[model samples]
Target: MVAPTIQPSLPRVSPWALSSFWFGSAFHWLLLLLILMPADIERLVGSAHKGTYLGLLSGLGAVVALVLPPLVGSYSDRVGKRITFIRWGVAANVAGLLVMGFGLRAGFNVYLLGFLLVQFGNNFATAPYSALIPEYVAPAQRGRYSGVMGLLQLSGQLLGGVVGALVGTAVVPRELAFVLVAVVLGLSALVTILRVPEPPRQELPADTAPRLGWLQLFAQNAFFWVFVTRALFSLGQYSVQPFLQYYLHDVIGRFRLFGLNLGNAVTASSVMLLAIIVGGVASTLLAGQLSDRLGRKPVIFFAGSVMAAAAILLLFGPPFGGVLLLALVFGLGFGAFTSVDWALGSDAMPSRRSFGRDMGIWHVAFVAPQLAQTPQGRLLDWGNALQPNLGYTLVFGIAAAFFLLGVVLVQRVKNLK
Candidate 1:
């Protein structure tokens, strides 16, 4: 009888590395709260120009996102010192937040400058930070690890929302919120710097340099399809997000929560955040494991379907309870998507040598959607002009379409099961 063949097991990851992943993910999600700050801007600018101002702000953010991450990622790859970049990026972010706090007290242009600084700094850190995942985790374990990261991200988002809601209630000053986020970001960075071990430096032969140019990679690589799917899906989600508060306020009307009368925007936002936190915990914990067994495509497809359904439900203008139910569904979908998508992207990466660069390019998928905010805002204004809340209706419909398109396009990726 022939001896049985033994399969090689993946190397075990350190506890410190896992902890770093958790903290890094938390920082990423916490930063997402910046997107929700247009309401604060509205206080300064007024309602009529809110869309225009937001368009300009998001556009500036997009410019930073477009330029910084890949540049920093490429530089870090060359230097073989990703953590150094991360530390510098965190310091820049803290400085930017401080400037923003002062700027908000001074004028809009100053606030814009500070916000742009924050964007550049955050993206600079994120590129190298995200590239660390594949270096640390084994292919067999990427799914499980991605799940944990997703859970931490959701937890961070929940925390940020709670903080924002408290600020809305005057329980904390608005500037204090910026301080809090900065502190959290700084702490997370410190933890990552101390805990996560860097990957061994690779010394490649001069003749073996990456053959494909960056732009060529976009056309010749299958990973670009992954980028496309993520970008389109994000565009769909963002098309409505900047306008959600306005919709809740203007269209849904105000209602009381916890015996304290609150604006419809705040009440709805709080409820939705709660629903996301509750629903996301389980989905995020489970989806990655399921994707490991069932394949990434199925989990992603299911998530897209669920998200599309939630978007369609929103189009009906449901009651508050119904809205909560829809939010739960959306959270479930988003949780699963967030958990598995990173693993999927890692699986499709073109070359390990260019992980940072490729991932930075992938980061563009995220920023590209920011550009959509302008068009979406314009669409909202035009639709509302045509009919009351027509803009919101159009937004949801467009969101659903993009979700479905993402689901379909993901099927085109042949590299991963």
Candidate 2:
């Protein structure tokens, strides 16, 4: 007998609690990318090979990111458990991070293993966790909730940068940063698990086929364009990001702007990142609420343009202070785009039955771009060999083109809102 419906189509979930895990996720990512990895790679390989080695590390680690999420999410979908998978991932992550700390002293291969494990652990947790919003939140509320997601996510990143800055200044031991990351991950995840109840297990209909892995998802045109646009934007970002510390060191060094002397390249990089995060935090929350009322495309349009303009401006040799302002502008636009990110994805998901599998597939847009890091590094290296600091100009130009292209293409997405 069919049961009569007794409640709303979706369950009530606290946006704050729902977004707690994002903070943990963004925290570790920034911690590693901004400080830990760069410092270690530079020490191990020297500055000349730093870009290439770092790219290799990212490319290798992303193999796990590319292959693991769909498999893990598909299994979680079958088993019908989210928190258990997430907890197990946390255990793995802590182990990996600790190993990385020890590996800092041990050797490069050992350090690589730690990074790979970190990827494994992070992807395993996130694949299952990614499905929660679509399953729990009402469509009308998604923008605001997504805003909350971006807000906490950036806030986490800000804290990570702060940790990096502290480490850069030698206020905190590098090893201690790993501990801080592990503790934060555990606490935030505990809050999410405690506050957010998992929905009851669902059974696949008799006729519905199980959603296969990544390739099958490409056949859905609506999602394919969404994936493409997102990948382009991310590619633009990774193009600049993976080499930002190097850019700071090589291009803009020892500038005194506004009575502030930032002679240290690492400290200068942290300041720029902080400026970006500050702008990002403000816009992330605002844009999410705006996307709810104004629609996703319009907000996305504004965001992409802003980012493109910033990238183009960066190609010009701006003063150190001017660059900081440009960074803030870039952050504002990027934050707005991210605010609407999940709402758009939720809107375009191909099948309700395969939220886990489909979201896992969708997430490849972010991961796939990391694969380009090797080529990007090679480009920088190649360009620099030909001339001095021409690599930064070439890279910045590439980033601008990516931003413009990504912005223009968003209009092509069906009016899913």
Q: Pick the candidate with the highest lDDT.
A: 2
TM of each candidate vs. truth: 0.91, 0.94
> TM-score of the candidate numbered 1?
0.91
Query: For model 2, how does the per-residue alpha-carbon lDDT over 1-417 read when each residue is reduced to its tens digit?
Result: 322111224568899999998889889888888778888899888888888899999999888888888788777776667778888898898888988877787889999999999889988888888888877887898999999999999899889877777774567788888888888888888888888876676443445434544577676666888888888888888888878888877877655679988777666777788888888997998899999898888888888889888878876767889889999999999899889998888777765567777777778788878887888888888888889888888887888788889878887787564
Deviation of model 1 at 50, angstroms = 1.2
How many steric clashes does model 2 contain? 0
RMSD of 1: 5.3
Model 1 per-residue lDDT tens digits across residues 158-262: 776667567645776767767777887787678778777565564544443253577777775468888998898888778866777777776777555456566
The TM-score of candidate 2 is 0.94
Give each model's whole-structure lDDT: 0.74, 0.82
